[model samples]
Target: MNKNRVRLRCTYHGCELKQTGGIPYLAPYFDPLLQLLNIEVLDSSNHWKLFSKHALVHYGKQFARLGKLKRNDVIELTAQLRKDGSFVYPAHVRLLTNGPRREKIPESRTELIGYVMTQNGLYHLGGKYEYPHYVNQYENWLNKKDSTADQSKAESSSITPNQSYCHHHYGTHGNEKKGEK
Candidate 1:
């Protein structure tokens, strides 16, 4: 057996049976593009995934050091086996990025990008998570402003007194009655 090949033990309660036929595991990392945890895999069909506890500790430390993983940071996967003859891969991992930036926006939003590790290979997490981009937010703000302006115009027009109706029906043009009739 190749020393690098992951070793596994039978997961029966009170029954300690080491097995060599277990599946490989690949840990996942944060993917900014997908805005979720993604795993890179050498082969997805191999049933490779992450070890939960290891992933948590690894990402916890990473988050502390880097603040948050944005997208495209390289993440490595570790393996683990369960007692029910099943497996649980890492569902989450830390965000590793180039560096942190203090955004100019008043809300203090930032962006980070990193890579995700999978059983197949390392994959790049895209720029979907970069904060302070503001394109979407700006569009929404503009739309609201336009809507409010339209509403104000409509309200002003509707609130005007019925001067035209009074003049045509009752000839009530305040001191100009003789000429108007």
Candidate 2:
């Protein structure tokens, strides 16, 4: 019942979540909530330029989906807590341009440029090619994903490149030797 956190109980299957001191269950919805709060605060300050920067960086896909850019833009994001405790964040992001940089950006290139959101607000994060800190968090996330994939691949395969291939290589399969077949 904290004033800052949005709490909703799941009605699906009568699932009751324990008070674990942290809402890890709601981690997926944190970005949406942050977006909502950011928009509200930005609108209050009437800073569409800053908002454009924010969208370009954090919402690359949503911004690319915009198709075109204008001098001013608005992106609608829904942060709904369902009765069953499920969270959905449907977004409608429209890119607005300023300073004569309006143009269609390739989806691959969109993520290359942008800003970083902090407690103070959005600031220029630069492109990935320039500063590592600009996309440090993102790069770390990608690395984490790759490592997990490698771990899974390693678990599924017993053979390693450093290991010498024996005569039973082609015949052996599923942890058994081909001669056994």
Candidate 3:
């Protein structure tokens, strides 16, 4: 065990984790650990912030031990839910070539990686918004277009056509006689 390697214990009660490698399996409800460790919640909107920060430090030390992961080296992340709703043994560990990091980690060591742990009360290993269904839903919303009235209203509000132009083009109120001088 390297001096800098920080061992991550199970946040769940009564679970003794002797080995420390891979990502730290965190529970959806991590406030208890934060309270126990007195880790301040920097942003209430991002729940996983604190845990992610700790994971990087823990993993960094592990990386140093394994001789710094090459650019394309595989890094796997596995997490399981214990009986008490916290992460259990995180046993299904595997390795794959470089994975995606849509939201890149910042240079600052204190930054937290925000992610949703559970959806509708089930423990899912994939981080929040990783499913195709959710991605499709977001795509639908992105592709949706405003109604005609909404478009007209926005156009009218932004650019008021000159009265003279309107009269010359369509005439006022459609009441102009065809031959009126």
Candidate 4:
């Protein structure tokens, strides 16, 4: 709803931390004290239990985004954030190692299984070997489908009743009904 509102975004999943909003940005003051509680990682379920249930209800599948962050990184980031009076934990702030960066497997040996990734670069006889963002493609396809449906609905409504019946008889696939006159 509020696109301009800055959120505590995850550097990994690129989603925001929902459980931390609504209250004052008090995590900075208290997150340091949490180390005393023996809560090592903010991602731990036990660590999350410290917050009230109502605060965490709308989190959906979002975790604390702490997996890629160290305890020191959290403390430092929180401390720096409080100074600026901003809760927006942006994606670019890299204080912790995201993990060992592995070199991409050479494209020469890799093959795609219809937008499905296969381990060891498994190759099928007729499969396209290109790596693609299938999820984005799927979302685009859904948008296209919805747009076309709306256009077709509008067109059908504007057409004569007889024309609408004929259009349905010979569908998009050019397959006519078995008993069509």
Q: TM-score, each model?
A: 0.19, 0.23, 0.18, 0.19
| Pairs with steric clashes in candidate 3 | none
User: What are the RMSD figures for all models against the true structure?
Assistant: 21.0, 17.0, 18.9, 19.6
Give the CA lDDT, 0 to 100, for residue 117 in model 1.
22
lDDT of each residue in 1-181, candidate 1, tens digit only: 2323243211111101112232423322232222223333333356544422211122223232333233345444333435443334433333333355512111111112222222112332374423223334534544665888799898667533644545535756444646563
Q: Residue 113 of candidate 2: its Cα lDDT? A: 27
Candidate No. with top TM-score: 2
What are the per-residue Cα lDDT tens digits for candidate 4 across 46-164?
A: 23222211111111111222322232332112211232232332233222434553222111111111112332232223654232332234345446658887998997786554455
Clashes of each: 20, 5, 0, 0
Per-residue alpha-carbon lDDT of model 3 for 11-117, expressed as tens digits?
21110112234334432211101111211122335343333312212322222222213333433323432333233233332334444532221221111111111
Q: Which stretches of candidate 3 lie over 4 Å from their true place?
A: 1-127, 146-150, 158-181
lDDT of 4 at 23: 45
Number of the top lDDT candidate: 2
Q: For candidate 4, list the clashing residue pairs, or say none.
A: none
In lDDT terms, how accurate is model 2?
A: 0.34
- Cα lDDT of candidate 1 equals 0.33
Ordered from best to worst lDDT, the candidate numbers read: 2, 1, 3, 4
Candidate 3 TM-score, C-alpha based = 0.18
Q: Comparing candidate 2 with candidate 4, which one achieves the higher lDDT?
A: 2
Candidate 1 — which residues are off by over 4 angstroms?
Answer: 1-133, 161-181
